[model samples]
Target: MSYRSGFITIAGRPNVGKSTLLNALMGQKIAITSPKPQTTRSRITGIINDEAYQMIFVDTPGMHEGKHLLGKTIDKLAVNSIQGVDVVLFVTDRHLGKSETKILNYFKAISTPVILVINKIDLLKSKIQTDEIILSYINAYPFKEVVPISAASVTNLDHLKEAIYKYLPEGPQYYPEEMVTDQTDNTLMAEIIREKILYHAQEEVPHSVAVVIESITPNEEYNTVDVTAIIIVERSTQKQILIGSKGEKIKKIGTAARRDINKTLDTKIHLSLWIKVKKDWRNNPNELKRYGYQDE
Candidate 1:
């Protein structure tokens, strides 16, 4: 029997459920999700392996105009991820807004097969509206396939996978079956911590916050790991807000992050979180590089 394997790049504007679709397809939570936009900051690869095929999915940061050095780097990552892929999953909601149109225009020029995945159908009121939305996209481009799915509820995702497989060529698996993601444990830890901050922090704090794992020490005798991370902010006022009165806010973020890390590590994790002011780190190229925003 012939085997099939390829890379599928998930592209969309910010907060359009790209991360949610990646997690749902993987059947596990490798990429972190929050209600905030630009929650994903890097090019993370999730592998789906089975008896007949291996589908490598690249979950990229949302495509949006860059507001700072970090934002520009993220936008570059998303654009770069679209290149040299076997298939591109252009994910969007029912609204064909300007950003979505821009993305569609960009994808139209790419040589790889582009599948229009209209996500969030679960939010639609009726099938007639879904059909109308599908028709609008159908007229926009000659897509290999147009699939409507609800990435949130995992509805119709199987059909989407089938649509992707239709374009995949027979090839060897790029990754081993045991490996599910390309991110290191340290990077994953930092992202998990950042996810907690995005979930708990208020206003602009989520965009300015960057968690750096300074150390991950293992205690062999106690079967526990000590994780020391520093959360970088732009100003002292932001630091004070993150720390909260009596350090309550930071404590809450740490507690939630620690729980999630413990589950991932399957061992007792001692998470030590600290706050620092970086004075517009997002705009500083050096600071963005230090925070692991450099392209790879």
Candidate 2:
């Protein structure tokens, strides 16, 4: 059988379930997801290897209007990811809006085929609602395929995969069959920690937070990994919120993060989390670079 492989970029606005779709498509959780907006900060590559094809999916940060240097950087990362890819999945969970229009404008300049993926269809009242959404986007731009799916429920994903496969070009496998993602262990650990915060933290606190793995030491005697992570926030109040009264919140975040890391990385881990204040770090270019957001 002939082999096929290509890169597919998942582009969308904030909180539209793009990351959830990526995780569902990969059949594993390489990408961290939450109900919060701007949860994804960078491009995450997930490789799905089948006997006849290898589909490399790049999950980009949500595209949105930026209020700070970090937000603008993330928007730029998402826009740039759409270029130089074999196919683009413009995911949206609702009808035409300002964000979708801005994304469609970019599609006009690029020749790459884009598939309109209407996510969260399970939330719709009826098939007519889904059709209305499909009509709205199709009228705005010509999509190669329109597939309505619910990423959270894992519905219609097989159909979506088939649609994606149709656009993949014949090529060699870019990654090994056994490999799933391109992210390093430390990056994954840090992201996992951040995901926990997003789930536990509320309001602006989650958006301002950044998690960095300080060190990862393996102990052969106990067959466990010792991980120390620092959680960065923009204000002292945010730190207090993360730490909570008597450190309860931080403990909850740490415990949840450790559980996920142990399962996802398939290794026992002793996780230690610390909170730090870096006043308005989102606007500080140096701080953004230090947190691995500027260089990308």
TM-score of each: 0.97, 0.97
User: Which has the greatest lDDT?
Assistant: 2
lDDT by residue for model 1 (1-296), tens: 68999999999898989999999998888889998999999999899998989999999999999888888899988988888999999888866778888888777678999998888999999988888888887777788998989988999988998999989999998899999998888898899999999999899999999999999898888878888999999999999999999999999999999999888757689989999999999999888888889755
TM-score of 2: 0.97
Residue 223's lDDT in candidate 2: 88
The digit string of per-residue lDDT tens for model 2 on 112-178 reads 9999999998899999999998988878998999999999999999998899889889999888888
lDDT scores in order? 0.90, 0.91
264 Cα displacement, candidate 1 (Å):
2.9
Q: Which residue pairs collide in model 1, if any?
A: none
